[model samples]
Target: MQIIEQQIKTKLSSSAKFYGYIPDVSQEIDPAAERPSVLICPGGGYVMTSDREAEPVALNFVAAGFNAFVLRYSIAPARYPVALLEVASAMKLIRKNSAAWHVDPKRVIIAGFSAGGHLAANFATSWDRDLVTEYGYHADEIQPNGLFLGYSVITSGKYAHVDSFKNLLGDRYGEPELMSKVSLEKQVTKSTPPAFIWHTVSDDTVPVENSLLFAEALEAHQISFELHLFPKGGHGLSLGTSATAIKSNGYGLEPTVSAWRDLFVAWVQNNI
Candidate 1:
């Protein structure tokens, strides 16, 4: 295994970071083999990136036959479009180095939790627009083949996770028009990538409605998607396993919920 960390070059230099977990040449028999990749965006409601969701999630993806990356994208004090732009830059860099890393650029997936989920969904729905074009990248260059969202923030309304959107909009938080603009559920189109979204109905932080709302939009657009609503559990349940549990006490661990990982791998096998 090889680990490579680098500062993602952006229009404005910032603290945003990108890390890749790739297989070394010796690990694979075929030098020309290209594996599907998953780029993870750990959620911190835009204030910071969570440690629980970063590497552990990447390790699981690696164990599941993927070259993985963790994106610690720009957070608060960095407003709207900044993190989005950073995501675009990360995709470009990954694709740029795809060959050397033995990654399949066309099969790259973006997975995020909480606010990061909002960002991933936003990228999926918004990538084909001027947001990426201004950076000299064609939409396809940065477009993800699929989205894996975990307990994500999908709305900007009453059920919204207030702090997440507040940190995202910054000074523009009160702008009703802008709030609706970034309310991702309303933004989904036929062009949106296929998605695998899961949320626990017991989650009070971001609410399960966020996922349901987005799923409805996907259905309206006739886009392919797989939605899972676990009857139990709460928000921020990274893997629903001890590996990503908040403490050794098994904080977020739940047997049934942990099965989401296997389900995700199966979905990837059939889709990617």
Candidate 2:
């Protein structure tokens, strides 16, 4: 899909600071038509986004008949809620201008892997209702049609990166209540968006338990979801790009961590 380059530097919660635009992509099949959209959050453990996070995934979204935006959210030297705010704002802007971009405000999805996965879950679960009540924003203002957590971190208790929490909250993590509130697992409700999740069993960095716990919560709530756990790839093996992806060309994405990309595409297409 051919796209125009748009770099929009938007405001953070502080409003005084500016987070870079993080390149975004748009496609109008017809000059006067709308399509599904996706907001891509890249992973870097709160520091940087991997190449795989920013490029390949964004391209795949585009090829799948959707408008995709790769959010180069602010990192470490910056803060946590900052990245969260940037993503929320980006979503709001996308929705507000959905008509111009030919996008279906109701079909917008958020996807991320690893740390990016963490934020994706947080924004979908944490920011959804609070951003509405606190800011007087309508449900239309900030909403995600669905969630795609690729080897993500949804719970903040056991498998979280303590250092990342420190960088994002400074002194906030000490507030156990606040931490619990932000933990994605605690926020699941009968109303949480439908989610499609995948992670490897061998993952050690963030742990597959993050996906397990979140998937469990979704099941309990009866929300629609699909989980794929490969046998042996470790953490960050997004869609089988791990040493396993190199070997089998896919990490159970198909079966034994194989053809996952295709599996995800098939699911997304049928659902959307």
TM-score of each: 0.96, 0.82
Backbone clashes in model 1: 0
Task: Give the CA lDDT, 0 to 100, for residue 160 in model 2.
Answer: 74
Question: For candidate 2, which ten residues in a row score worst on lDDT?
Answer: 14-23
lDDT of 1 by residue, 1-272 (tens): 99989888677546789999997766457767888899999999999999989999999999988999999999888888888888888888888888899998778998899999998998888888856556666776788899999999989986899999999998899798899879999999878888999999999899999999999999999999998889999789999888888674668887768888899988988887
Model 1, runs deviating above 4 Å: 26-28
Rate residue 165 of model 1 by lDDT: 92
Alpha-carbon lDDT of model 2 = 0.71
Q: Give the distance in Å from residue 85's predicted Cα in candidate 2 to where it truly belongs.
A: 1.6
Query: Residue-pair clashes per candidate, as listed?
Result: 0, 13
